[model samples]
Target: MPAKRRPRRPADDSLAANLRFFAILMIAAILLRSLVAAPFSIPSESMLPRLLVGDYLFVAKWPYGWSRHSFPFSLAPIDGRIGGAVPARGDVIVFKTPGDNRTDYIKRLIGLPGDQVQIRGGRLILNGEPVPKLRVADFLDPVSPNSPCRPVPGLRIRLARAADGGAVCRYPRYRETLPGGRSYDVLDIGTTPADDTPVFVVPEDHYFLMGDNRDRSADSRFPAEPGGGIGYVPAENLVGRAMVTFFSTDGSAGWLMPWTWPGATRWNRIGEGF
Candidate 1:
């Protein structure tokens, strides 16, 4: 006698089970993105010579711990932040604007809690000492839809031709060495009102930030206003620390042109670590 076989699951029930499995998977993915790491895109030139427009990078969420700001739409239920850690100066961070608590801004952390920060004569002064600013080679940014050579008041937008015949925008770049020897390049486009500012004492649990593009950025130098400068950001507002550049484009790619995608990618900028 042949052994009896078990009845197969109903087709409707099987389909429902599969749907449930997929739903779980999607939720897991969303949780990972909200708590582990998430991708962020650079949409401005405030961090130029390092981060450029169209650059997509992953931000590690665990570095500064989790807060309501860490979750999408600031929906986390926990009060303040848990498992918090101190962020190092010179770490590029993403945070919610103090002005709105919704707008996200990325800038290099300059002044930590209880630190003094000021800008004078286009030089960064931290803790009453000047951060070394050494003149460096010009940053030859390729001109594209993403990076246009815009004219600044009282200054010319220097133009250059790349060896590959691409139009290039030349900006004076400098290397700044902060305390503890951490260093990075910055662009200084002549003088601006923000070049001089009174010393700012960072309050407890707050951090001061500034952009690499000294003259063009509306950072801590200005008063916090909606759709404008971000004042000192509270510790609870920190989102993540930038980890690596995953992808970049020159804004020349068109959705309708498949072949243009490859050529429009800024291959050299990808995989860059912060």
Candidate 2:
């Protein structure tokens, strides 16, 4: 009897097997970054003190559920894939800008759907009630060549004892009490153009946002006028909630010189949960 020939696997079968393995890995990475956590960088000081420029943060996507904004692109071409719970007040959220979906914004949720939000005499009023505010400290504007010439008012000089027992001139601190009793720090710049803005009622399905920096940030208080900020943002624009800071650097420092790395890196902010 002739020897039986051994069976052979087709080349197409080998190629298909490899492709399937690659596809699985890609899908797993996407799901992990989209549903669990992702990294975000702070490009501006809108949420200063709490978040600083150059601070790299980790945003949690599952806390409030996933929206169309949660996908790789702001718009969900395939619907019903991801959905999230309604965002709550006092939560620090990251979202796409209303008009331009390409831009991302991070702000504390001051108003929710159907809530009336307004800033009167520099105090936040929600649902026709004044949110309690207590002065904290003065905020000093860092010297920069391109910085504005405007000076912040109501800034009281205070002595802040440093770690080495040296005192520095610092502004007072303030606490903002939300309706649900959530309070956070706010810089007391006294009064600015943003303090006397008109009252705005948050439309249904939309939200009101304000920057922690108050006077310096261009947020929902003053849309993009000559020198204004973004106005109220819709719920659909929310991307995720800021969870914690993973890395940070002082804006004044640069990474050009290797010798400057030690001083430039904000080691204390590392591993600090926001």
Q: What is the C-alpha RMSD of each candidate to the true structure, in Å?
A: 3.6, 5.0
What are the lDDT figures for the candidates, one per model?
A: 0.91, 0.73
Judged by whole-model lDDT over C-alpha atoms, candidate 2 comes out at 0.73
- Of the candidates shown, which would achieve the greatest TM-score relative to the real structure? 1
Clashing pairs in 1: none
Query: In model 2, which runs have C-alpha deviations exceeding 4 angstroms?
Result: 1-23, 78-82, 137-169, 224-228, 251-260
Identify the runs in model 1 with alpha carbons over 4 angstroms from their true place.
1-9
Candidate 2 minimal-lDDT segment of 10 residues: 141-150
lDDT (tens digit, per residue) of candidate 2 on 128-161: 8999998765554332221222433455444455
The count of backbone overlaps in candidate 1 is 0
lDDT of 1: 0.91
Error of 2 at 171 (Å): 3.7
